[model samples]
Target: MTTPPLSLRARRAIVMTAAVLCPLVAGAQTIAKPAIGPERPFTAPARVERTLSNGLRVVAVRYPTVPKVSVVVTMQSGLAVDPVEKAGLAQFVADAVQEGTASRDSRVIRREIFAMGASLTAFAGQDTSSFTMRGLADTLPAMMSLVADVVRNPTFPQQEVDLLKANTAQALQAQLASPQFVANRVYRQTLFGPHPYGRVGAAPETVANIDRASIVEYHKTYYRPNNAFVVVTGDVTPDAAFAAAEKAFGTWARGTVPPPPTAALPALTGRKLVFVQRPNSVQSSISVGNFTIRRSDPRWAVMNVANQIYGGAFDSRLVRNIREDKGYTYSPQSTFQAMGQAGLYRAVADVRNDVTGATLKEIYGEIDRFREGGPAEAELVNAKTYARGLFVIQNATQNGLSATLNTIYSFGLPNDYPETFQKNVSSLSAEAVKTAAQMLLGSQDSVIVVVGDYTKVKDQLVGFTNITFVDISGKPITPPQ
Candidate 1:
């Protein structure tokens, strides 16, 4: 028989007594932290490489876990190849490539892509621009053909070019209202000077200057088979993928690509500070940056680990100091990017106008602290684990694998980069990380950009003597007296 229900007073007494005893019982038991297991070995999927008679390179990797595939055709010419007078020409050409092809208009291209259950897109970066497509496994050949048509046969229709320019001009106006955009533009300009890396985007005036003739000329000069490669990943056989690439791109004529730009990066002697005055603003967007190394540098792994321990990780010293401890900002982050010719390290935070100086102080303090003594053994181990885990997760999908292959070939990395990446990250020593920090982590010789109401933050920024004042357009102006 079931026990009879207790009276209300009796039930309350029993619950209170059980709650009091549970803590005592829990305190008496000691639980050890579970040991972390050795990481399972990762075998990179086998990749097959082929070259077409016209000098187009194709890399195909077999990833049969899904029923789809991703393909990216990347040209080595990008923003760096943009003529100095035409800042956004490469990106303009990239965007226009998908607008219309010789055989099909944008509308027809979109319809065909939709019917195949596919997406087609393109973008330009500092060192490379790529046209990418993803579709069903059975549609691999069709996807390749479409991407080839888009890249090789862009018409750069005059009407489309004019509309794109108008749209871009409008977009630039909207972006300028953002303080972070202004801060970044000024910061990069300060760091890179006349280097192509500094020119992140075109101004409204610059966009107005982009015409169909320039777009066509830019594409003809750079979009050559000899200067590009295709990466395919998914549930497709290597032979089938290679044949699709060759069949699609074999007839495309190779062109002589101009030598890459060789502009010198500006030297950073002392702290270069700039302030963009956004009147009546309540917050400041700050960017602290310094030039570092190239993507293929042997020291890249060491620098990456150092960055993670210092600020790259969400739980890093910078985040802990500025966000968790001082509560100055939300989502403060630092990033290390390695480009084809150079690299950059940047830490950014948007803080309340009053606490901007305090946040900067803490950022510099954390950098100095990390550079002097390096990460502790435990911190180093944790960072390495995170890095290795991140690498695996990032490349565990078809899209990610294709992008990885794009980066490998774009930066001239060895074919076995995927195989060696985890091992390199795991092997970094604490001393090596500290050495990297000392070599690159900057406090004195850095570019600092702050965008806010100049009057509100000017007093806090009094310590900076080499500061330059600019308006939202990055045009220099006299600071308010």
Candidate 2:
């Protein structure tokens, strides 16, 4: 049997008692968070730089965090230098470099590296190619020698090239199935047009064009000592590191290298929208942004702070608006990428198909609002703290420090970039960040790309004009009615 309802007087008494206790209980559970202390001064580890007689620059940093070291050999030639007809040749060369050397095959090289508790990896980027190895400090010289051999003596075995091509074609097919990849590919192509930056990677068609001769020729043209540098970070002295570098790579001959291609970027105006139809997709992957400055631009500090305040951080305006407040999506973010030649500011999110248009509207609204009103003083302080802390955390490890040094040398940044980073970020005023936001965060001069099923998302996109439809391979196509 159920109890009868309480009288109004009894109910009022019970409610008053619960309300009074609620405050007391809540106060008991409310533990105050620790206040953030003033940031400690940070000084980047000292770097000792030397140029070999062969013109190879060696940078040595005494991190000494552990009994390990990170050695990276970086070539200034990367995707930006690829021949127009042969996009992705640089990455192809990087991939094949470790297959075999003059005296060691892939198996022997792997065995040696494994025995030394090391890992060697090679990759290419927009403006540089890198072969990096991390291992015990005792194996520093051996790591250097192995990487040097891979960089200088790869024969580009025909059999290995054939296998690589087959594997790449399969991989490209798999990548095409991913809407994120499709969206990024189309986004870059739409923003940069015919510029080399538009080319993502080796297409199957381009992979078919690669041969051993072309690989060898590309290597010979760009893999010269004059066009490369070495960064070593670990428990080692400068003199010892330099000696190891000389012993491993001294004989590498300097060669004449042509200037990198500098094709002009196509002028972009208005809000250009490009859609790649991924039929039956349940979600829309949207990427929108515009070109910004170069890597060496002095305004980098301000732009970075503005980016963090706007969307670069989890507690940013875009995330707070679209993901937290509106519940339209999850994991939305904005980023800034700068190369030696150019820079980009991008905002990306994956949202349900039903909210595609709403998400886009919210993203644009947040960006416009942030640009106009700027960040609050509290927002500015938090952003700076996050940025400075992230910088310190990134450089705290041997691998991170080595990569940071590579970015410095590869992009022609000042040698003292890390040293002055915290000060530069901390000294910026709210007005400076606002000015940067105004300069960089407008949607009028942006490119929008969405990868989803047109049938599912077309109605949601009615507000957007200048729409162009393309297939997964980026070929122009007519959408289904």
Candidate 3:
């Protein structure tokens, strides 16, 4: 009749968390020896950078740990550039780049990457468009050249564009029906409003509207060395990486300046709720919260501290209350996503459809409480220590460090960001955190979007809304008109 005891993993996690939080031996407050300390001392590998005649910045690092090379070609253009009529063109274009190139077809390119034990990739995202490759270092020259070709000469074959359109339409059909996908789709809608960021990646009807002509325009406008960068990291020296890159991308043409992001997003304020009704489902996925500060804000350290304590990690309040106390969900977490231009803050969780209302109620109660009360002293200290400690691994891993470096440089932050993080986080005061929480946490500006079984949870959902029922394609389904 009684519930069983907590599992060993959960019990050990609690104890380890406690030790990590307070390893001091009394008066001095010195940190204890690291529990799983690294086998060797940490040292930053040197990196080198260059600017091409055409204005592309190149950054390279030689890793030597594994021969696998990672070449990333990046552009400043991102989803912020999506023309209103073509919401997902950048993504499709990124995909098409590898589908075929000036010298070889998509099939040939795909075969080359696989034959050489490499992966070819491209990502057109919200703020940046990029092409990447991972392969043995000896094959890097060939891979880099292939990447340059894709960037320079994406033929955008008519048939391929049609294929992408059809594939994406099918994928969108499946994704729209997924609970978490639905939660994200509508959550963005409610949070960002008319902003391109708010647009669903694809609506069933909208996918068909995409065509090759629009794809070509988006590509020509965005992909050029003048607007991009080349970043290489992994098992080769900077000199080697540089030479390999130059031989590939050196002569790529410069491009005209991109027009500013299609439009700026407006601020979100006040409480809002969105509900999607799935006729039969066992559970619901929910997302709540709204935008926070940009990545480069002076308030980052304090905001980071506040978020870590609130829901940035498992030991965070959202987890403690929403799962451990209420037993409504498996887990709850929050993310403070700050990038070069802007940022967003949101918390998410999933619970049985039957408990959707109760789970949401508890989540809000915790968010508002933390905003008012601030994190406990123990919570604050643990979060600070955790934030500072993460830097070791952040710098230790080749890919991790490279990504960190790219973000730091891309955002125009000072070179010492990795070093500054720990000291800054540790120095934050409780009051500073409270101020940040007030700024970053829930305002009535809070928005909640839930996707779950309609028949099971609608009555409960009505308690919060002037309810709106939208279907899987993100379309409004009118009852048998």
Least well predicted 10-residue stretch by lDDT in candidate 1: 201-210
- For model 2, the superposed segments whose C-alpha errors exceed 4 Å read 1-30
Better of 1 and 3 by TM-score: 1
Ten residues in a row with the worst lDDT in model 2? 199-208
What are the lDDT scores of the predictions, listed in order? Answer: 0.88, 0.89, 0.77
Worst 10 residues of 3 by lDDT: 472-481
* Model 3 regions more than 4 Å off: 1-43, 262-264, 458-467, 477-481
Structural similarity to truth (TM-score) of each candidate: 0.93, 0.93, 0.86
Summarize candidate 3's per-residue lDDT along 118-151 as a digit string, tens digits: 8877776667777777788888788888888888
The CA lDDT at 315 in model 2 is: 97
Model 1 CA deviation exceeding 4 Å by range: 1-38
For each candidate, C-alpha RMSD in Å? 4.9, 6.3, 8.1
User: How should the candidates be ordered by TM-score, best one leading?
Assistant: 2, 1, 3
How many angstroms is residue 432 displaced in model 2 relative to the true structure, after the best TM-score fit? 1.1
Residue 318, candidate 3: Cα error in Å is: 1.3
